[model samples]
Structures are given as structure tokens and as C-alpha cells.
Target: MPIPTSNGHASRVQIQEPRTRSPLPPSSSPIAFKEQQGRPPPAAQQTIAGKLSRNLFKGILFSQLTLISLLVIVLTIRGLILASSHHFHPKKWYPPLLASVAVSGVASLAWQCIFIYNPPRAVKATFWLTPILTCSVGILLVLIGSAVDAGIGAVFVLFAITQSLYGCWITPRLEYTDKILSLSTAFPPARTREVVSLSILVSVVYSGFLVTGIGGATSTRTNLDLLFVSVILISLAWTMQVLKNVQQVAISRARYVNFAHGEDMDAWGAFRVTVKHLIGSICIGSTLVPIIVLIRGSIRSVNLMSGSSDEVMYSGADCFSTIANKLITYGNRCGFVHVGTYDKGFVEASSDTWKKLRSTVGLEKLIDSDLTSSLCFLSAVSVGAVSSLTAGIWVLLIHKDYALEVTLYAFIIGYFVGRVALAWIQACVLAYYVAYSEDPQSMRFDGTIPNRIQRLQLLSARRDNRELEVGRDRDDTDNC
Candidate 1:
């Protein structure tokens, strides 16, 4: 038993060691090993507290869409009620409305800069705030028109117009390439980038419309021509936006289809096809519709100039501007819903009174297309019809009496109904696109992103929490 000392015996007997083991390949390095574990390395996970602080600052106001919507609704409702019951003068309404537009538009523009300039992690909050502030401003402007002066409100309308164009440009730029390629029906980024660039380049050209409208209004002292110019500007702005929208949507669908089929190569190919189609569509569809509208408007403009029942022409012009403002305000607020040719008549007819000229012209017959293009066609017609009808309503309900009471009641009843219907259509269309675009396999992805709205809020919350902890630690350190 004493002699059975195993460790001592083994040490004495086993003198030779086995050959040393070879190190792993570079691909199997320790850094890679940790990455395989599904977590970022410690250095990667670490971030500065300033990031959270910046996010908290940016997102404090913009995170809650519900709150923003409620605020807008409340303010709009209050203004409408006061205007209706008190019969406030046009001067009073114009000032407040202009103030709201200037303030909100400026705020939104500022926030957009924040999103671009904020610390990396803080961007979510900055981006979130932009739309809410912008929307608040826009809603105020629209409501203001009903309260006091639709003519003056036309100038402020450019804010929403510019914002939409900016969104289409920036969102596509920031978003994933795959998403852009998938959604686009044309040159995808190339065309989008061009549109954005061209808009910036031609800001002067576009601004000419505003200047002309304002100048014409001043020189002629005619509300009708002013309204006509505003209406035309709005129509052109929307047409530009929608042309880009169609390209985006087409590419999106094509990319989604390819991805869904598990054919990554095919998906890219499909995206290319989509891009081409989008270009053709924009050339064919977008340009064509607006041109027709412009031609008709031009003819009408000529007739009015030639002394065709100046009252009726001006009345129609006012009608055009009012309805255009309503549609632009509401349409921009709502998601992009293009009610094609068929829906135009429905929307036009929905108004309390009918336009004999609009009805007799039968524009639908000339521009009507199938259901796939239904949204585009409808969008053109619906925008025209809606703008015309709302203008008529404003003249009938408010301008004639110099009070907003009847207009407010009509807006409350009509606007909400229009909103609900529009919202339903938007929700359905968006849902369909989103659902259809998703791949069942992609759904299983560990890192699949959530909705844009949700993602921004979560990022903001996380950033805020981090900042609070850092602040607390800093305070404790100072105290000690």
C-alpha cells in the first residue's frame, strides 16, 4: 500500500509529452468565436451615455402619435367651434392659421435637421418628432382656412407639399437598398435621387407657381385666379410625389416577391424589372394625368380671362382652391391613397352639390384605366374632385355668411367621415403591401425589424433609460 503512490510513479514513468496542438484557422479566431455566440463583443456593446441623452432630447415630444393627433384634433375642434359660434372675422383667422403654419413648418424642418445631425443612436427620436410637429402645423393651417381665409392659407400649404417630397427623398435614401429595389418599379434609387435633386434644383421653378399666384391675386385683386393658381400648384405637387410613389411601390413588390420565393438572384432581377416598369409608368401615367388636368385648367383659365361669366369662373376657381386645400391637407395627413378614375366620380358626387362643368366634361372616360392602375387614376380624379367640392362647400357654407358655424358642422361631419373612409382604405392597402411583401422565412429571422413608428419609440426609450443611469452616476460622483 505504501508503494502504490500513483502520482509519483506516473511522474517518474511518463517523461515524454505529446506533440503540441495546432492553433485554429484565422476564420476560427477568438473574435469570430464570440460573434458566433449571437452577441456583440464587449467593446461593440459599450456606448456613451451622451447618445441616450441626445435621443431623450430629440424624441420627448414626437414619440406619441396618439398625443399629437389628439392635440391637432383638439385645436382644430376648438378653432372651428369658436369661429362658428363667434363668427370671427377673416383677419383674425388668417393670423392664427399663418402663425401655426410658420411655427409648425419651421419646427418640422428643424427636427429633420436634428435627425440628420443627431448622435447616431439619438436619430430615432429626432426623426420621430419631425412628422408629428409638421402634421400639427399642417392640420392647423387646414383648419384655419375653414375659420377665416382659404385664399391666404394657400401659401402655407407649400410646407406640407415640400415635406412630402423631402420624405420620399430622404426615407428612400436611409432605408435598406433591398427595400428600395423591391418597392420601386423604375430606376429605384437613381430615379428617386434624381427627383429629389431636381426638386432642389428647380425649387425656383416650382416657387414660380406660388409667386405667380400671389402676384396675380395682388395685381388683379381676384380671389378666383389666385385660387386657380394654388389649385394648379397643389395638383402638380401631388402628381410629382405620386409618380415617385408608384416607382417605389413597384420595386417594393417585385423585390418582396423574389425574396419570398427564396430566389435572391431572381429577387434582384425582379427589382430591375420593377424599376424599368416604374420609369415607364411615371413617364406614361404620372405625366399624362397631370398634363390633361393642366390643359383643362389652362383652357378654363383662358375662358375666364376672355370674360366667361367672371362670377362663375371665379366661383369655380374658389371651389377648386378650397377643395384642393382640403384634399391636400387631409390627403397629406392620411397615408398616400391614390383614388383612381372610378373613385373620382364617387368622391365628387359625395359632395352636397355637383359641378355641372366637371360632370359634363366626363374626364373619367378619357383617363380611365384598369384596377392595377386604379389607385393612380383614382388619385388624380379624387384629388381634383375633392378639391373642387371642398372649395364649393367653403364658398357655400362660410364665405357667403362670413361665419364658420355651418362650415365647422359640415367639416366635423364630413371631414371625419372622409378621414375614416380614407384611413380604412390606407390601412387596408398598407397592410396588404406589408403582408404581401413579407417572406414567411424572413419572419423567422432573428433580426427582422418592426414597424418604423414602433422601432423609433423603442430606440428612444432605451436611449432615455441609459441617459438617466449615466446622469445618476454622474450626480453620485459629484456628491462624493
Candidate 2:
């Protein structure tokens, strides 16, 4: 061979070939590697098992991400709306708004602790127990208030409404459970989402009405007292509707499960049955009371303002002053009622005017009384009871009339008693079924729970290992 020359000056010169990198191994190439292994192309002849696993993983990842994203978007929207409405400003609505937020947070935590979803049996137990307990307290308070006076009943209703709403907001956020799950055949996820959306809209409207109506209600046949009563009525009616929905949900869940178990239960059939019960119970019981209160209060307010009664002061300034004094005096008396007999004196003195008119129609007694009379006493008793237990609470407390104070006291005591009774009933019902029940699905968990758990764990581990192996293969091919 002739020597290579740098300057090509020699008679003969050899040129070295330029270096070029070797192509990748057949194992690394998309088509060639597959052919080398005597296997079909992955896209065309992918193993069914591998494809299924990949699809499942992708689905799980997508679902998890979607849920997280949805939650974030909802929260962001709510925050933006609140901010734009100036409700987020600390100077304006912060006190009540913050209070509501704090209450809602705590309520949510409580619901998660008590009613978080687990197995079917646990879910049923929780659902049955919660409604009976909550509704019983509410009903008992109503019954007691009827006997004593509205003042007593009104206090319980207010507490029940607030607590219920707080629980409602919290359940979906934390535990993804709904107390109203018993109300409709709509899926809990979908139903709760709708309910929350609707509730937010309703709340905003209600708040706007409240803010605007406050001044108008204070004079000219419109007083905060009457406006507040209207609000309470609206709230009560809304609550009843929610309760009806809750019943429908329960029936739907039951029918769905039944159908899944090869039974003949259908959604429409269950819905009809649910509607009958809901209309009979919640519609009649919850909605009626508030509606009647609203009507009576409206009539009373219209007549009082239009008439030349001793209470009427037609001058704008005089009317404003009178309204203000009435409010202040009412608030003050409500606080004072529980401490001494001052509230009782005022209530007795106004028995002909604001006192409850007891009359028996057929088998039931219709006790007609104004919500104002009821609220004053209820507020005073609650305030006083709290004040008595705590020192500085006295400063924040108000007193109302004697009958109202006693009525409120009775309502609170009745609620406590009702809770206990409801709990006992649920326990009894659960114990009865657990002891004497023979369910077909029992075979599903016939083996020791630990054995099933172990199987699940093994499946998970195998899946994880397959993923790891696939990842490792890609990394090796890249390095090569």
C-alpha cells in the first residue's frame, strides 16, 4: 500500500476513508427490531393485556386530573365573584362573610368525621341515621314552639337552617358525600354539583334582597321585622324543597342497587313513590308553616302601617325614628328577658296584640302568632343562656319577652331530646337488620377481608412492576 501524503506531492498517494457512525442495533429500530424478534409491529399486534393496562392507567390519570382541575376552577370562580362583588372587602361584608366561612369549614369537618363514605352498609347506616336525627330535632322544635309560642320555635328553626346549610356546603367539598343524597335519583356527584351551583345563586339573590329590603322594612309598611320574616319563610320553603330532593335521592339509590341485583325496580317507579312521600311530609310540614307566617305577617304589617293606630307616626322623620326605636327596644328586651321577668311583663302586656291566639280547628290547634314575637324571645333566651355560662357574653346578649324566653328554652331542650330519640331509633333499625338480614351480596365478601386485600395488593404490585420494566427498556434503548 502507498503511504498517505498530506500534500499529495508524491507519485502515488492513498486517501483514508472518512469515518461515519454505525447504525443502531436491530433491537433498537422500530420495524427492524420487531422483525428481528420474530414479532409483529407493536401498533398492529400489541398484546391485548398490555393495551388494556395502558388504557386503564391513562383513564385513571385523566379522571384524577379532571377532578382536581374542576375543583380548582370552581373555587377560583367563586373567589373572583366574591371579590368583584366587594363581598371580599374586609370593611364591608367581612364580618358576616368570614363568620359564615368559618362556620361552613367547621361543619364540613364534622360531616366528614361522622358521615364519610365507606362500604355500602356503613353508607346506609350513616344516611339513615343522619336524616332521622336532624329532621327529628327540627320537627320536635316545631311541635314545642307550637305549644309554647313561635318565639321558641323560631329560634330552633334558625339554628337548624344555619347548621344544615353549613353541613350541606362541607359534605361535598371534603368527603364528597351529600346529606341530600336521599332526595333524588340523580347521581350524587351530579346532583350535589347542581345543588351547590343553585344554592350559591340563590344565596347571592337572597343576600341582595336582604341588604336592599332592610331600610324599606323599617318604615312605610315595610320593617326589617317583616322583611326578615319573609326571608325566614323563603329559607324555610327552600329547605323543604331540599329535603324533598333528599328523599328522592334515597329512593333512587335504593332502586338502582335493587336493579343491579337483578330486581325489577325502575327509576320512574321509585320517583313516583318518592314524590308522594315528599309532597305529603316535607311539603305540608316544612313549607306550610313558613308560608302561613309570611302571609299573616304581611297582612299584619300592611294593616298596622296604613291605619291611624297609636303606633303609627306618618312623618318621614318620625316614622324613621319610631322604626329605629322599635328595633332597638325589641333587641334590648330580647336580651333582658332571660335575666329577669322584664321580658315576661312585656309579653303579657302585649298578649292581646302580639300574643298567640290559640284555637282548635278539627283535631289540631292553630296557634297564630307573629314571627317577630317568636324571634325576640328565642333570641333573648339563646343569648341569655350563653351569657350565663360565659362572662363577657352578657355584653353581646339581648333579652325579649317572658313567654318568648320560655318558648326558646323549651325548643332547645326539645331539640336535644329529639336527637337522642332519633339516634336510638337508627341504632335499633340497624341492629335489627344486621342480626336478621340475609343479603344475596353477602357472598361477595364471604372470604376473610384480608385475603381480598392481599389479592388486590398483589395485582397492584404486578401492575407497578410491569410499568417499571417498560420504562427500563426505553431507557436502555436510548443509551444504546
lDDT of each: 0.31, 0.30
Candidate 1: list runs displaced more than 4 Å. Answer: 1-196, 199-204, 207-210, 250-438, 447-480
Q: What are the TM-scores, per candidate, against the unseen true structure?
A: 0.28, 0.25
Candidate achieving the largest lDDT = 1
Every candidate's CA RMSD: 28.2, 34.0
What is candidate 2's CA lDDT for residue 106? 31
Model 1, span 1-480: residue lDDT tens = 011113211221211121322233232233322221132111212134523432442243234323433433443444444544444443433332222222222332332233123222222232333334334333434554554545323433454355445445544324422221112221111132232233222332332223222223323324664464355444434433433434333333322222222122122232234333223222233333345445555655655565443687777776665555343222221111111101111122112112211242321121121111322222222222232234334444444442232222222222211221122122222322332222212321212123433455566689999988988998999999
